[model samples]
Target: MKTLVIIVASLFAGVVLSAPTDSTTKDSQENTYSIKVSDHGVEKEDTIIIDEEKNIEIFQTVDSDDAEVVEDFDAGLEGIIPRNGDSCYVKPLNSGENIPPAELKSRLESSGSENVIQEQGDKDDDLYVLAGGPIKNRAVVGETIAEKCEGRNIYWLTLAEDGHQDQGRVKRSCYLYYCSLRVYLGKGRYYYHCYIVRYLC
Candidate 1:
């Protein structure tokens, strides 16, 4: 009788332990700022949803065929120019004229501008000379002049005839044009134009 009683007691204990215990759960929801992307630009109208269960759902009709999209990130690139530097020899105009760097330097020196500057690039493809200086006379006829004092950003280079000819032609034609820009790095921002004919030789 005692053994039977013990067995019945053990069975009852097991049944009680297996019964469902108390459980309390909490539900949480939140809104996060988000934007939808389209070909035109950025559009923001809805919020991203997140629950206490770590589940996330975003409601948006984004165009997958968009040209570009930028995520949440930041980046950039850097470049610099020397205090005294030269630019690569770009064709002065849209026309054809092959002038040697040495000849160009000589022509610039003759301008008679104080502090005539010439900076050569270390590489062959670099601009051989960036020659410019102050001119005594700011006012001239048919010439473009730049002045930093006046908060002006651009001016023109003067063009005049150089008596030397490149090939069999005694007088090759050189059309002069005025050029100027505001963002020059040096101290002074004035220069005169020098004209020379392009010789095929």
Candidate 2:
């Protein structure tokens, strides 16, 4: 807590101190703020741009995804949805539509999002999921994950967005140009997210 206060204080002081030295109108409008920290011989800088008129801020990390908002969920394996036996539907299943986790994961396999599971007697595919997050726009989720696929084949380019209970299936499908499927998490507020389907890379 103390360290955070110090950093915040330093940032505030720097901004105020620079106000008089910088006279360009464009520079004042930029509202671009950067903070650099040195700890144990390691130095890192983060840039944050604030748009006062829009009441929004964009955060840019040194070498990571640009997060529009600070997310309260994880982005690892099954970050959006975990691997549990109990199944729930993010969207109303058809009278006979029952898509399980394994099948859903299979659709996204080419995405290179799966991490091998070490369980015995289970075909070595213990767990699989399409995971990455905290990005502002769901539309770019696919684009963002594509950059992380080093040399592996990208079979899936996915996008997950929240679905309001009032929205109809067709409306949602049209929103995503026909989403392949939805993955419900084990338990959490984000269990209602729908993960869009296969856009190969």
Candidate 3:
């Protein structure tokens, strides 16, 4: 089945660390996105676009009345086009989302997220499919965890990720987690990655 219905639009003037090449131009760039929903063989699609000055509003804000049906459309997407962020997005093929190994490597390197690409000898990057918020960087990730956990009166593995991070007071309290988020941009898709000092409280 095929259908389209644009029900609402809202704007989030986010910080633009950079612009998508070939997809926009100076003073006249806008990102318009459409999503489709299906129920009982019926389909509905909605689109949202906002362009004002240098900031580009891509999705509807999560606080709007339409949010209930939008699935937090703009969650964790601020400052990520390009951003002080950690994920990469790839649009899927019309038929499916499985990525060829070569194409996966090409996209990760080109997306400026090569640092997170997990390749061993000769193979596609160890990319993971998941959803998440953006992390400013490794340093901020550590500090934020420290402050938040400390505030909750939880003894944690480290203070911050920089050199100052205290090893987990209890060896068992610490864990080193790493992954590259490859978000498939289509229906119900989002992508971002992080290389942070993750620890248990």
Candidate 4:
């Protein structure tokens, strides 16, 4: 009886060891795997198939909202005009004259209350004069003036090329003021001498 049992155990062990390994039967088997991925708050599911030759094929399914296309829009400087009841003034730009801050403050105060500085041009319009030579950072100065005096019809006057070419005018102007008009004065070969004038609302 013992000999028979040992023979049976030996046969069972041989059969288990000789059984086909997973790799040997892999070609006859097919596997399906599901994978999930999330990106930018969107979740997606993918299915993979392993064929007999161990080649993988993938298919993906995504929600309609996740695949949607979006567009961006930008509106620059549109509808930025000052509202009603806002006062406007032209801050003068004097070339080569360094007016003290105290003087400027006093001038602004006097002008605000008494309107000491008369309008340069037509009563209905405002005129700013840029009298001297070419100014440095003309664009930057114009932008600053425009921001300070809003809701006003502004004008800019700069010396023409003829005046800038004259050598006798030893005084060089820097940082002159210009109007708030959205006019594009091409920065000519010479520095621009411009003025910014603001009309009262």
Could you say which candidate leads in TM-score?
Answer: 2
Per-residue lDDT for 1-201 in model 2, tens only? 111111111110011111112123542332454433222234445454443332322334332222222111112111111122121111222322323333322332223222212111211100112233233333322322323322323222233333222122332221111111122222110011122221211
Best by lDDT: 3
Lowest-scoring 10 consecutive residues by lDDT in candidate 4?
Answer: 7-16
Q: List, residue by residue over 1-201, the lDDT tens digit for candidate 1.
A: 111111100000000011112223364343332322111223312122222132212222122111111110011100111112121111122112222223322232232322323222221111111123332343321111111112321222222132222233335432211111112222321221222212111
TM-score ranking from best candidate downward: 2, 3, 4, 1
lDDT of 4 by residue, 83-136 (tens): 332322223333233222233222322322111111122111122333333233
Task: Please list all clashing residue pairs in model 1, or write none if there are none.
Answer: 87-127, 88-126, 88-127, 153-182, 155-180, 158-193
TM-score of 2: 0.24
For each candidate in the order shown, give its overall lDDT on alpha carbons.
Answer: 0.20, 0.24, 0.27, 0.24
Deviating ranges (above 4 Å) for candidate 1: 1-25, 42-46, 52-54, 62-201
True-structure lDDT of candidate 4: 0.24
Q: How many backbone clashes does candidate 4 have?
A: 6
Give the alpha carbon lDDT tens digit for every residue of 155-184 in model 3. Answer: 212224233233324443422222222344
Model 1 residue 44 distance off true place after TM-score fit, in angstroms: 5.1
lDDT of 3: 0.27
After superposition, which runs of candidate 2 have C-alpha atoms over 4 Å from their true positions? 1-29, 63-201
Which residue pairs show collisions in model 4? 158-193, 177-195, 177-196, 178-195, 178-196, 179-196
In angstroms, what RMSD does candidate 1 have relative to the true structure?
37.8
RMSD of each: 37.8, 20.7, 17.1, 39.6
Q: After superposition, how far is residue 193 of candidate 3 from its true place, in Å?
A: 16
